[model samples]
Target: MPQATFQVDQEIYREKISTAIIRHNYPFMFVEHEGIRDLHSFLNPTVKPITRNTAKSDVLKLYKRERDKLKHVIESIPSRICLTSDLWSSIATDGYLALTAHYVDENWILQKKILSFHHMPPPHSGPILVEKRHLSLTDTLFCGGEFFHVRCGAHILNLIVQAGLKVIDEAVNKIRESVKYVRVSEGRKIKFAECIAQLSLSCSKKVCQDVPTRWNYTYLMIDGALMYRRAFDQLQLIDVHFKTCPSDDEWVKVENIAKFLKPFYDITTLFSGFHYPTANLYFHGVWKIQMLIKEEIRNSCDAISSMAKQMKEKFDKYWECYSVVLSFAIILDPRYKLQFVEFCFKKLYPATYVDRVKFIRDKLYMLFEEYMCLSSISTSNQSSVACASGGDNIGDEMDEFDIYESQHYGLTRNKSQLDLFLEEQKFDRKQDLDILTYWKANKLRYLELALMARDILSIPITTVASESAFSIGSQILNKYRSSIVPKNAEALLCTRDWLYEKGNIKFSNEDEEDEELAEDFESIITTLKNSSNDSHSSFS
Candidate 1:
């Protein structure tokens, strides 16, 4: 009998290897690693080792194939999409632009997809950015790009908090220095642990140093230091060189500042959240944030009051008034509707609330009419192309309003869909309603208005989605990811996101380079060795 030989399907092997690379964000050179090759050979001698070049080619092919499928999906979906664009500059001065789309799918599930991850080579300026985006995506844009240029709400909130943090900088710096000093060496950390033990301090936390540019880290730095207060005080007594320990008075200020910042931190998390519909929540989030800052401005504590005044100044600078898109979003939300808009508008604009509310309501009606007219034109265009029963030429010669009035809504439809929506009793404020689900359930009742809701509700309150893409890009574009060409760079990033879309990618802004823990004090003290266990995991 002839010996039977086993053959490996090289095509399937290469594709699966390419997929693993993208899904796990492994470097392309991962295929060429000696251990990887050895493992593959031992598993099946028939399989051949592939080079990084082959891996790169495989990745590009996969990207192009999958991208076409996603494009088809986007076209078939009935919901109009909302986009977010973000720019990231690498350590090597390379600029990457990530554009993402958010919309409700046919099944009423909210979907977010990456549209482009382009390698932008340039002097990164507003005009250069605008020109590039215009040339590339102009034809595909919805509403003719009228509401496209949305500022990231989370980024603006960061600016406001960053400006506020400046007021308490002196106190923050002192606590920050103390954290840095202790984490410098294992000896210092051991000694610091002794101080905690000596004081019988029950705080199980360790001090965390802040990345000064990220306010969240500053908040964490303050929060953690506050826990180890007595230990830090104890460290000051023996670690004579640790002169940056905050004064008693300064400590009070730090405590108060952290207390004041807690709500801001929570609000940011709420705004930056990706899984839920944020557009409907946008109005309420900002309203609470502004309300908190306004109250703090009149705080009994002089330091807090002073800090809030500066924050308020910055807040007003950016959010003198809200956007029409945001206003439209909340109006579509059942929990708020036009009634809540009326209430909030009065608070936002006491003198001009009536006119402002009317202005927004009129715009909503006009927007619905725009959607109505477009729906008619689309039907007419399709009919003309298909040579349908009527062979209607009305779309070309008829005014758009005429199409809306004659076909969709006429005089008797007074108390328009918008009016009917507003007249209905609003959902109770305490109801736990997901806005997308609410609109999806009611989609048929108000046909044109539901189209508006589908688009408006899917709008992202923050550019955090694109920013998260940058975090993944930061890993892929780094030194250890091998020499990825610009085209391959986009392919790797975009493919990773598409392949792993089920598990949401979260990149925490926390600084882990200053880690001083992940060790048993008893063993590390005896061995005098460095230890680390956190795997740099992200929340799913």
Candidate 2:
């Protein structure tokens, strides 16, 4: 007998190597790592470690395999999907565009996928972005027509609040500068810590720096600094160099501004949720924002009123273009539907309430009719098959009559799906009531109407999902890893998300070990500090 030779499994080997590259955001040259080569050598003496070029090829192959799997999933699904896209500039001054798709699968689970994350060369104008998207999505199974483009609601809220923030820029600058002054050096940090200890303040949270691009960071910085007000006061008394301490009136203004901005912050956070449907929740938030603006505009304080005026201008500028799709989305929610929309819109736009309500109702009906036509064609084809099979031709004819009656009466006499859904008692369960669950349960009952709901409900209220992809891109393509070609970076970023979604990846035990080490180090430092204090007391 010939001696049997042991052969390495190329597929498994390639998978293990690809996993390393994705999990750690490793460079393609990672195969050249001494430990990696040695481990491969130990596993298979006959197999050679892959070179950088070969590793890159394997990574691309893995990416294509994963991309094909996702494409199959998107194609297999029968519902429309919503897309959110955003442009980001990397540390290397490279501009990249990210597109994410949102949908509710048949299991009633909310699903988000990063459809594309790739470089968008210079002159990133609107038309250029649109053209880039058309190209990127061309090969994917998803049809562009089925997708509705939604601007990120959180980003829009940021813009609105930033407009209001401009009203108190000088005050915010002072607070920010004061925070930077305290955090700039170790001596200042020590001095500030001493002041906190002396004041006996319960807060252990340190002052934080604010990034100008994110208004919420400013909120957090001011909120944190306000907690150490007395400490700062103490610092001002002893430190001659503490020139940036906010004055009493400035502190008061900061407090008022924070208070005024709290609702916007809360709404932004609420809308940024990834695990649930936000479309149905948008109307209530927008209504609350409108009410808040009105209330603030009539405030007794001149400063707040002026700020509200600026915010209101920005809010109207964007929201006036609020797509009818948003209204349709809310109407599909059984809990709200057309009645709730009418009531809210009447209160919101009292002057043009009649016209707006009529417009929404008409648009919703038109949408329903469109879906009904599609359902009719599908039902007719199935019925024709049943008739040909000789199961029950008479029954099939009767079923057609029922569908015709439903459509004719439902449309001409206000007995349609919209009316039926609206007239039925609204779903009373509010807490943890899954909107997708309700739709799934009632899909058969409403038939074509349910199909329409699924498509519209899948539409996200914001582009935050795409913005989050940019965040991941930033981490993957940081300054230290600037040499990562855009193609590899895209593969790494998207694969990471796909693997996470599929539950094929998890945080390593090393993270837990590091956390434990940190805790142990902190405890040791505390012990040393107590020992030093005790020694000083004994000496005294």
Candidate 3:
């Protein structure tokens, strides 16, 4: 065949090559047959010139389109949503915001979706406002859904520590000293780290002195330090700041710190025992202050009228109890105590000062009077009603592995013990909605929607909704493609998967209606069973 080959025209050869290339899905273009490697080298020699986008520009366009597609898909989702947000600061101090949306499905089942997760420019002023703005954008983009401030559960540990410090000044001081010691001296830190490493079976030197919000990371460092306390003490002797005898007033500081931290230990214990437990919701820490508020109200209710009459007599008492006055002052002023407790309390109780005072007095008095009667009752005399009564008992359900299992504070709750708590505490689930109404009235509906949203989204606060675009963006906007003018990330995120079928994402508005449907379905199934049973009996 080669010997018989005749000289073929270049045009004919190119034509044959083009046909073959089209039919065979070959990579090469016909222009390469003659070794012509022009800018149009990718196309066949016969292929006409057409206005075309560069690979980088094409990808940038697609990326932008995909983002819009996703945003559309999310916005079309009809329901209330809750968000979990966390700020990430990389080693470069680059700020990244991770926000997740949670919602419920049409069947009223919980769903979570990563709504947005990516870096936002660091806020120059108030970071919270930036967070608020981001949240507002999510709501605006996704529609008028509510947002429940589910601040990271891990943050509660620090709060618990703060609360624990209030009652246990010595322990708080010791912890503060420990924190300060590590921070103040490189020598002390090295010694402490060495000591802790020796004592801990699983200690990491790298974890020392990390921020508290890093949570488990910070805990690891402290746990290690505690494990090797003897070695740590040898490495660095803790000087006695006071010259007082070790057995006398010095011990009281230790006692006070312990007292402050006792409630925190209780919270820790409860969390450690949870089944679906998240560490450090700080519920108990918050509850302690709530209880304290109740206590103060009870103590202060000598009636303003009666107090005026006894004002002169109480002068000595005032001097003795100046700490109480200072505590009250701190509580009233938002500037003191890091602004957390007061801020949270105000948010929880959303009423004005006068209104809050009146509310606390009325609500606490009613709860106290009711609880007093129940507290006086014997376990044998108690009923399930007793277990489900008090508002305070509502918080008890937060204990891990308790209700689901047979445990209370990690121990088996014998029927007697269960009955005792049930009688004494009387926690009713239905009443929860009512109780929350007092605190959550301004925000209950909104919060409920947020809970529903979180349920339906089927994702966690850690979900990466927006970051999904980041890799694609980077791929298109590489150094080689930096000339590409890409669309904004938000627009891209908004419209991804817009036309796709999203099954049952819109949750049913009426929970009662769904319940009714379920009941009807069960009834139909029961009727069918009954009919079949009758037929079987007749045959028999």
Candidate 4:
């Protein structure tokens, strides 16, 4: 095709190209490829295809623009933000912390933003990590972070499951060995398949090995091996070398353990979701996990009983006494108010159920008072206050909806909103309730307690959001792109997320970039390496 005289805006087109490179996680030099350059030239004879340096500059510019835009959105938010953190190491022996923020905006929609991909050196201890972030963002944290340090539900479940899995170690080893043997050679695989065919085994599953560290994969390995037991038994009779097949008794033990792990696997998948699962939604998942552990603790099988005890210790260490924040999250759910809270605690700690429930109730009331004080100052200008008392709008749309004064809302001035919330009958649990929508629709009703719900609901159930941010690490920090400066690298990763927020990029696992570390920030801060304090880089 002949070249055409295309009068394209040079800088504008360069930015579009730069956005594509970062959004798709392409290397800056991708634009420098001969084919890319030639294609641009053919399409626009007046076009100036960017060199690698130009691509880098354009990416940084885009990053700064988006960072400022997100910063303003964050600063203007009326409710507190929840955060999740992840620390990562690069091939260059560099450390980066990825910070992500989850919050309900003024419009009452849940939002997640990557605030920073900061560079930090080694010695990433608990205190050091805390201090590094507080150096700049301590003020933005909720209530001085007394309720911060929310553990990832999925990670704790993994730990508990791994501890319990110790009882099945012997059975798992035998299955692992048999799978390795079958997979070691093509001949062995074919022989195993023949054994399945000849034995007329109904199982469609092929035996596979697990990574050992991951309990879910281990569950799959054992689950599949148990199904193909007939084939393994047949192989043992036919092949002299297939001596590692699990015994019938061992298979029976494996089956019991798989049953024990099935609920945990389900919960992990639930909590690890990127978009949907919230802290409020996790009460049932965690309650079911606690019950399952208690159920197995009394099992007739010694191995299963012993495994449950081991897991109980881990669970007690992390969850039994440490789920105050999570409990608060569940209490905020309109479907399960104080009654469900009492029910959950009564089931777990029967003897002290009353006291435990009292403790949570008192703490919630105290937290609500703090929010009440904060809201008094922030709500002075709220036009909703005018509309509630049958007054005119203060330069905004207003409505006289006095539910509090009406008997329908059970309005009482002596009782606080938290008390009133507890007294009201729980919303129908069977009904579909978008909790955010519920709170937003009733914002004029409960007022400050509704603000607390905004933050509590935004609390992440898992670190999966931050972890998913690293899914693109393999594509970004490869040998070819490893030399990209830390400043540019942070810019690229931050912009991909910023682009996703703007509807310019799809936030799919198939394409993304990995930055250094994790954790959410109050603002969209893509902090640069402390060593290179470039002024134009706004988030730093």
Candidate 5:
């Protein structure tokens, strides 16, 4: 009977372990909550509930186990992996850096895995960041040196939109102040809602204050306020104290600004994807942005044309020379190879069109030659290994004779793999075409070139994946759990991501909803306080 009891207790402990992992529940959940502890006691009063410290240890053990498995998987991959990284600061002002690895697995599926999420000491310089991250300076891992560092495409778009926004700062400020007035007090919100009812306006979204740091918040505030424009106009008349209300001309300016920023907003959303290969899709979007800016420059409105000119200046600063890796990615897309790049560059850079295309072609050919040499070396090594293992004396004799004949006759193929691939017809199916599948299907035919394509296409165009790790980190290190040390924090965040990726658990939607709600409320309160201070200063 004692032995039977011991077996039952062991099963109970195993169940507790499984419960913690499957639910992603906090370590303290088991001991802090009376109901959970009571339930465990009822099952086996002799067995004590694990303490939070013990639970943390269990979590660390689990993380190490999963990390080892992941490391093994990463090591097994033949293609070079591309990485994206970003630095984030927590609520406590502790700096953390997240690094994410992107690669295509053997089955032609794109995989994104977070390699690290650790605290970085102060002074986050570029050299220090790379060194602390333990990434090699001269390897493919660092993209053959830092110049090849692919800045987050979404982040770049944000910078461009923010610069353009300076053109309509006064107009945006007015709209922001108006939204702040309505959102600041319950009484003002009720009054606005009443005005909406009176005006019979079909406003589904409430007035949301913008967070100055996030460009999307500005877009949302503008889009939402525009929906209740009529109600806001009515509120201006009813509430005599509503001094921040935007006038008709200001509203028109806001509408134009929203229209201008819509494309940028869409591009950010497009490039922030995690599951699919984005490098191939980047060239088209970037080219579209360039065209959009050019079109806006020719607009009849002075404000818009001026904004476009400033944006064009900023665009030229960043995209003066498109990164060669991006260009190579586009060239590999069979659908839009060298020809498409040549055409786009000629149109985008009419003055330096010849130089730009020549540079791209030259770089591409150089990369092709490098891949061919690597492939030849790999093939020769494999041949040597096979000959050694099989003890193929006859094959060795044949190889010697063949080499002598080749050297004497100078035999050569008419065209290389790169040439053959370039000569092939571009993929006819443009709609819903899978780039990975295309490469995988033709990998055997253009062996070396396909390997290069697989590596290049696996690279993510944005560091949003790393940014997303910070999002998960925020949830893990919430207010109540602020006491979690960086070590434990890393363990929890990395384990959570690993489990979620493996389909062992799902993150709660409520957590995300709560986070967004908190951000929105914080922005509203902060904006209200700033506006109130400004009003007081003006009156004084």
Candidate 6:
């Protein structure tokens, strides 16, 4: 039997040899042994120095060729799909955004990563949103021939966050500060880690050791912090919670720190109800969030009717209970009583309530204004266009009524105008993406580009896919593996199709072959027995 080499170098070399044989069959016939040397001789008879331009050209050619294959795979996929994307900064501080394409197989099981691509990072808020918009547009353009781009729920979650960054920042900061109080010092952190470890032991899982200042399991972290009331009290009890040499005033705040964590506790409770299947509890939670918003608006509005005032307080108290859920709720439709809802919510259960209520209020006002403007425009457009020449006509009557309504409410503005004061507190909306019109426009070109490139580039549809490739690349690029040429990497990637064909090749012998081997073994056993008997006869 011929020896089979299973090492990476041999496998890579074999691929080079095979490709060369297929490309120049005549040259392969001349070689005594089919190997890398023989293939290299066919490609280049003389020893030629490799140049930077040559290397780049080779990589680009390989990339383009492999990418086209990936594109074919993506186009062949026939089903609804989802797109996943992520952004990471490399050692060079260069932004790398990866997009993944997902779809369901014919069997109705989830199939992922038919395509993927690396994108340039957005440096600032405006550019980030712009980049996000462009990606969406580009994806739609690519899939225009077939398959509407499916919205990745994860990406949608990011979009929702981008839409509400202003309000989110304050809440995020307070959460961060509270987290810092636990992590910044060794004693406090050690104690906190101990408390976490204890709980994790009880649950038989690793404890989260994420930085306190960041949003590490925002809800759960907050929940854990609140749960350890005794630990916090003990820390405060010993005055060891703060830095070793802390000011008197800082120490006092540390004592009452438990009270500051109340909002987080309230939030956790509200979010928990969603995880369960109790319908009544869910409805009650929604009512609670609604009432909180209504009540705050009443207190701020001077001309609140008795009925409105009664409804306002009803919302305020209940809204406090669900303050956490409201914090991250998507502001999809703005015209829906946001003024009263936010007013009551901020008043009742503001996270970092003291400094953030005003800020949250400002964000709500802007969202409300934008929503109302869009709704008004949509409604007006549905009606017949108002003519400039309108004398005693239907359009004229409508105009007269509108002016009269405006006059009746004039002399002073309403609750909407009062909310405008909150607007004086600047909350930048230009930061972060808002896909408010994404669905309506059906823009999915960026996703399609990613999908197409997956087949064309022979890459996956997400950062995860790229990550998988890079992991292979890393193994190949290691010191021990460094001798691997980039050409080999390209060849390995291109020949990945071989992996799919592995199941088709047979490894074990067939039934008849096994029977024949068994017969031969039996004959050998008989011969051994006869030899042993003959030796025994000679000894006798």
Q: Best lDDT goes to which candidate?
A: 1
What 10-residue stretch in candidate 5 is worst by lDDT?
Answer: 502-511
Count of clashing residue pairs in every prediction: 0, 2, 51, 16, 0, 37
The lDDT for every candidate, in the order shown, is 0.78, 0.75, 0.36, 0.76, 0.75, 0.37
**Candidate 2: clashing pairs of residues:** 152-463, 153-462
Greater lDDT among 3 and 5 belongs to: 5
- lDDT score of model 1? 0.78
Q: Model 6: residues >4 Å from true position, as ranges? A: 1-9, 12-69, 80-91, 95-97, 114-116, 119-216, 240-540
lDDT of 4 by residue, 47-162 (tens): 88778888888888999998999889889998777777888877766777888888888887777777888877778766654553652364655455557677788889989999
Which stretches of candidate 1 lie above 4 Å from their native place? Answer: 1-6, 130-145, 198-206, 274-277, 378-413, 508-540
Q: What is the lDDT of candidate 6?
A: 0.37
Per-residue lDDT tens digits of candidate 5, residues 437-457? 999999998898898888888
Which sections of candidate 5 miss by over 4 Å? Answer: 1-32, 43-47, 130-147, 204-206, 274-277, 382-413, 428-430, 501-540
lDDT per residue as tens, model 6, 1-540: 333333235334444444443233222223343464445545545423333344334434544666677677657664434554555543344444444454433332333441433435566242342244555557543222222222222222222222322223333343335455765555655555444434432322221222322222343333444444344445554454343222344333322332332332353344332221111122233544344335433443332223234434534334333332133232221222234345544555577544454554454444345435544677785554444344458777887977887799764344443243323343243444322232123214223322221222111111233233333333334455344344444443333322331212111222333343211212333455587799999999
User: Candidate 4: misplaced stretches above 4 Å?
Assistant: 132-144, 190-208, 379-411, 501-540
Off by over 4 Å in 3: 1-78, 84-99, 105-160, 163-223, 233-540
TM-score of 4: 0.82
Error of 5 at 178 (Å): 1.8
- TM match of model 3 to true structure: 0.33
Q: How many backbone clashes does candidate 3 have?
A: 51
